[model samples]
Target: MDLALKKQILQKAQDWFVESIAQNHIKNTEKLIKPTEFKINPFTAVYLANFLTGNSNPESIAKALVYPRVLGTSITTSFGTNIQKFTSEVLSAFGSTTSGIDIEFIDQLDGFKKYCQMKSGPETINKDDVETIAKHFSGVLNLAKTNSLRIAHSDMIVGVLYGDSGDLNAHYKRITSEYHFPVYDLSPELVPFS
Candidate 1:
């Protein structure tokens, strides 16, 4: 990454971090307590636990009801989305997303175009997600062949925004080891890797 783009990404990341703090601020606590897409409010389990603990005071009851909301789920979700967006924006300076992948960038050292699917972190995926990623890469490869697009399977990369190769999760390792896909971490070159 060049210095200018790196600065842009870092600035955007800081902006997003500030916005996330706003969501959980005292005046914005309602945003935290809002019902999630999959989880409904008024969890009887929390109420039951509070009852068992004999902290049945009104303030204690309210705190128990709202505790899970303030656990930083929104921050995690926002970080994942914003990180991908900034990476895509920066990589767009190198190549376009014309190949039907998330983004493509010209490798500064090798001078080859790299097709990428940006992931937030190593732990962001699961078993099924691994297979789905393979299928997407294969689909793009097939499309490239049909159109005489000079692309290689090796050009496909799973770009992880966080976590070094040493501490990578099993899913990321499987992408490279079992699925024949390369996992690249977006970090300084000083990190250790095999």
Candidate 2:
């Protein structure tokens, strides 16, 4: 990602968090134990809608407001779940929506399939976790094969969505090499915050 875009995304995310907190505080001033009854402020609706569609137009905001349930859900503390949803939305732009395994898409032209596991960034992992992940994927693949599913041209892909002080790029490299899977660095254009 370019320095300018990164800064913009960070600023947008921070702004959204700050605004959301303020809105929640104001809404909770009445000491209502059940918060879901109150609708989220309009700004939050626009923020979420923009995050999903990358458009801040009034029509988009109005359309986004139609889904009050999504607006009611608070952002995760670490933003991990939000980033995952953002990545899933991005994949859906390419006509994919199977997120049981992070992302699974079928190429319409060639009948090829791609399976992906997504993470917000790199984190420390022990040997046990690695083995468990491998075993889990093995089971999934085996089940697919047993069910006579189309496994042709299927590639196991790992996508890292962002990085902070940690060397997520290096971690992705290590994971790809160790697992013999391809790594896609989506940090450049995939801005979950914006």
Candidate 3:
């Protein structure tokens, strides 16, 4: 990443950490929720520390916070499935069968899939692998990261709206008005049996 992009990402990460902490505090009070009652099961302290310090193991941090393990597993599984489909599509687009692919690129793709699946494993995904996958896919990783962040932040807003007993339609209108992004009443249409 360029210096400017790195700075932007770091800034965004920090902002997200701060906002998450604030949201957690507000939810704790508003919902009359004891610390133990948090549905997500993650403590903000460990989560924020992992993001800010970058020294802590993320999985260990998640464990310490009692973060929902299933979420990570689901994300990893979804990513793996998508990657498999993407790899096949890319190979087909290149007019080459998977069997005829160069060994080096094939090895890289296998490693990438393994890396995605090992989200909960002790082995961290290599930065080189991330870069390689990002480069190979013509910015798909960049798009994914951007979309993921937007979804997470929007989900936070949805939580706030629900907790406050705010009008769902009004909240949706406000989100669209402020961000110009249509967020409400949107359900992804997944292909059947994909």
**Of 2 and 3, the candidate ranking higher by lDDT:** 2
Highest-TM-score candidate:
1
Worst 10-residue lDDT window, candidate 3: 185-194
Flag regions of model 1 displaced more than 4 Å. Answer: 1-12, 19-54, 89-100, 188-193
Against the reference, the lDDT scores of all candidates come to 0.66, 0.53, 0.32
Indicate the worst ten consecutive residues by lDDT in candidate 2.
69-78
- Which candidate tops lDDT? 1
Model 3 CA RMSD to the hidden true structure, in angstroms: 21.3
Against the true structure, candidate 2 has what lDDT? Answer: 0.53
lDDT by residue (35-130, candidate 3, tens digit) is: 454444346656654665564575555443433323354344444433333323322212222221111121222222111111111122343533
lDDT of each residue in 97-175, candidate 1, tens digit only: 5443566777666677878777777678888878988888898888889999988877888877778777777887888
Per-model C-alpha RMSD: 4.3, 14.2, 21.3
| Rank ordering of all candidates by lDDT, starting from the highest | 1, 2, 3
